[model samples]
Target: MTLTLDGEKIDRNRFTGAKVENATFHNCDFSGADLTGSEFIGCTFYDRDSRLGCRFSRAQLKDASFKSCDLSMTDFRNVSALSIEIRECRAQGADFRGASFMNMITSRSWFCSAYITKSNLSYANFSKVVLEKCELWENRWNGAQILGANFSGSDLSGGEFASFDWRAADFTHCDLTNSELGELDVRNVDLQGVKLDSEQASQLMERLGILVIG
Candidate 1:
């Protein structure tokens, strides 16, 4: 029985295909909103006594969808969010610095899309976001800042990523299967079409000591 909506503005609202449930939205703004194919369930948008969340700056959010949302410290700066679908969201320290999940064709060619599965996104910032070829599966990303982020050809299979650095984010052809990759320093992060398994490729070849016996 939530339905709070504190500082409501609902900027340029449309809420396309709306289906909202268990709403809260404390510092609500939803700037330039469209929310295409919207479906937010169990929403909160983080208030927690004036901690203030909801903003969605420049939002259009194509194919927007969320589930079990809290969206802690949410802002989602400069959003365009193609095919967005954040599942099991918590979104800790959310900022999404200049988000744009691109779809452009010309002018340096673009191809990005969002899915953001099993989200927690601890310390989320995503500075310089691009989100190329995205799906972003099984998310937690313990300390996600992602400076100059690209996430090239993303899948990010079964992610957790404790204290994530990974050379300040590019993850070329990413799919890090069954991921927990804490300090993934595979010769300074450029595992072209990366898709590690088999005990994380024998723990990154025993940290380059190459002791993957048998």
Candidate 2:
């Protein structure tokens, strides 16, 4: 059974195991609410101001899509989010550690200081997202869309960016050791103080059409 809520005031309601589809909520407060095993498909949680976004602390959001929602300071720790789409949300300081997602797309969002360590993010698309100072180590970002994203001051070891477009991202002071950079395109991407492996350096030189003479 699925529940549809539109233009309603659902402040702090327990929506465990609930299926919300095509709903639009405004000025609703979901702070400290437990949405364990809940699925929100094509839902919109809109809040005009950036100071106070919708809160989903420790909510179980598996296989869901939160479109155009403001999740600033939203606690997403240890939540299972498989095949989720958190589109265009402000997730500053959002804790995503220990949470696993597959084929996920978190596009057009500001997720600064998002603790996303030791998680599986393979086949994920985080393109055009502002991920400044985000904790993204030991995670699987292989074949992920990280273009035009800000990864400044973050440790990105053990992640693979094979076939990733680096034309518009900022990697200033980022640690890229032990990471895979398969055929990286470093056009317009900031790489100051970034440690690259031997293969990564070769790929950049090869893109520049510069061959080393013996």
Candidate 3:
């Protein structure tokens, strides 16, 4: 029996550097709250009964981390998430639309950062999100909605991309070695500066009907 703390209103609160576990925050408003350096483990933010998810929209999540958490169908829209880490978490169908991971220095000058490794991101909405130069390796991206998303210079190595569309997002300058490039057509998607292992390259060549000799 998993005991859960439900319907807790922690919005606009400063829970910086705090650690929470096994808590259910269904429909809870965490908007504009400071959760920097906090860690959440085995926590659930989605309510299956009402199909509602907790709101982390516009939250300060810099360096905030989550591990083994069920964040399915959660709202993370427009959050400032620089250096946010999510490891081994079940974030299926979570919304990350409009989330900013970049630190702007001046006009046309900025750098992005985030460590989202080993998480399940299947069917998650990242449409039009900019995640350039971030650490996003080893995640399961099956059926993720990444239309018009920019992932340039990001490390996406060792990821599982079954049923993923490479043409829907930008993968230029990305390290995609040892990843399953499902349906990734080399002729359709731009692969400039994209790194792939020899085996993956050969597999892609086979898809284009090109006979890879040796």
Candidate 4:
């Protein structure tokens, strides 16, 4: 059940349980289509235009560019996406668990309620993005620029965030247990109502030049 969409324009179509594995879509357009429950394992989407509910589980999107489209609720679990550009898209409720994103630019996108566990986001720029209530546990975010982003009520436990820029970001009521914070800068970022241990809070405050008197 494999479908190959090469240089095709498929607009407003509903494709469910469609197997699109090992296919190559060159300059294809799938705007406003409902591709829920679709599997796209080992597929290549070069300069494709896909939008809204395009689910892809265990897919390998290597060298793909989903630039400037609405790709909400798109499942990317266990997907290997190298050099992908998902900039300025609505990617809410998209599951990216166990995915590796290398040199990817997913800036200014909405990732509300998205599950992104065990993903590699090193050197990726999620600047000015809205990530409300998203699950990002055990992920690596080293050298990533996440300024002015909203991460309210998100679970970021056991993640690696060494030397990242998180200025003006909100972490209200978020969980950050057992996460790596080696030399992280928390200046101008709100830390109220955040779930952290005393040692973690003290270490974070000490980095912010706050002297604790007993």
lDDT values of the candidates?
0.86, 0.56, 0.89, 0.57
TM-score of every model versus the real structure:
0.36, 0.45, 0.93, 0.53
Give candidate 3's total backbone clashes: 0
Per-residue lDDT, model 4, residue 83, is 38
Which candidate has the highest TM-score of all? 3
- lDDT at position 123, candidate 3: 94
Candidate 3 error regions (>4 Å): 1-3
- List, residue by residue over 11-103, the lDDT tens digit for candidate 3: 565467888878677777788889988889888888989887788999999989988888888899999999998998888999999899989
User: For candidate 1, lDDT tens digit of each residue in 67-166?
Assistant: 8899998998988888888998899989988888888899998788888988899889998898877888998989889888888879989999998888
> In model 3, what is the error at residue 204, expressed in angstroms?
1.0
What 10-residue stretch in candidate 2 is worst by lDDT? Answer: 3-12
Q: Which stretches in model 2 have alpha-carbon errors above 4 Å?
A: 1-111, 206-214
Candidate no. 3 TM-score: 0.93
Among these predictions, the greatest lDDT belongs to 3
> What CA RMSD would you report for each candidate?
12.3, 11.5, 1.8, 11.0
Clashing pairs in 4: none
For residues 1-214, what per-residue lDDT tens digits would candidate 4 score against the true structure? 6555655655444443355545655545554344544444555543235433444454545444443343444556555554344543444445555555433347654334355566556654455555666666777777665666677888888878887765646777788888886665556656666677667777888887897666
Query: On lDDT, who's better, 1 or 2?
Result: 1
